[model samples]
Target: MKIKSAVFVKGVVGPDQILNDGKHKIAFIGRSNVGKSSVINSLLGKKGLVKSSSTPGKTKEVNFFLVNDKIYFVDLPGYGFAKISMQAREKLRNLILWYLTSPEIEHSRIVLIIDAKVGPTKLDQEMIDVLKDFGHDFVVIANKSDKLKRNSRINQLKIIREQTGKEVILYSSKTTEGKNDVFSKIFE
Candidate 1:
């Protein structure tokens, strides 16, 4: 699917603020600094379309972006950062959990991202477990594949599949690798 247009629709703080009215949506979820924004920009074929930050936990709110008016790429806030305050982290966690539980999101597919370099963490596994229990259709996408050796990348995918019981598409935002594959899955 061609990205005719992609725009940041809103930054939501709670479930009530999300504009979830039957539009197809796929969310990006991962730990902070996992290159979520970079992938979003790459998918849109625009530089800096979604704010990409070097610092972790920069995306504190749920960002919804409309793509081709056919689907919404929901950028949920990053989690599992160690430097943030406990209360603030709790709020972020609650916001994401609420959105995951929202009825409106029940119909949408989820694209759970894992940084290929770091592999999956405890938080990532927890999120996968939640998604599995929620009984939602989802796919794993291993981002930052450009940083790994080809063999290591393949091994990482195998490890992730063993841990989460889900297949993952390898991708790199820097080289536009796996861009078409991801979009095909999203539009399929």
Candidate 2:
């Protein structure tokens, strides 16, 4: 689907604030500093459309961006920001868990973002395990692929697919690599 317009809809910290107007919701989630915001901005064809930060944990609340007037691209809080206090981290963790497991979240497809160079961290694997335990399938995006050497890029992608047992897209938000594949999946 061609996106003529995309805009920020709302930012929700809990289930009560999640949009319930029946639009399809696609959410991006990953470790802190995993380029989740960059992917969202690139997919929408807008620079800085999603507030991204060089700081590891810039996105704290769940951000909802409306795409094509039919789907909501949800930007969730990044996990594994170790610089923060334990209390803050626990709060963010609870918020993420609540958002993921809540029935109030509707018509949602989860997109788990990974740093291509770093591969899947332990936290990433835990997230995958959680989703599997819950019987939810996710599309894994190996972001920051341009940072990897050409020879290692394919290997990383292979590893991600093998580990997740799901479709993996090698992506570079900077180069817009894998943008079409991601958008097609979102529209699907």
What Cα-based lDDT does every candidate model obtain?
0.82, 0.86
Flag clash pairs in model 2.
none
The TM-score of predicted model 1 comes to 0.93
> Each model's TM-score, in the order given?
0.93, 0.95
Q: What digit string (tens of lDDT, one per residue) describes model 1 on residues 1-188?
A: 76789988888886643555778778888888898888888888989878989888888888888888767888888889889999998999988888887666544778888988788899998888777778776778889999998779778889878776877788999998998899878767
Best by TM-score: 2
Please provide, for model 2 over 1-188, each residue's C-alpha lDDT reduced to its tens digit, 9 standing for 90 to 100: 78889999788886554557777888888998898888999988899889999988899888988888878888888899999999999998888887777766674688999898898899999999888877777888999988999899778988888887878888999998988898777556
lDDT score at residue 163, model 1, on the 0-100 scale: 74
Error of 1 at 89 (Å): 0.9
Off by over 4 Å in 2: none
Off by over 4 Å in 1: 104-107
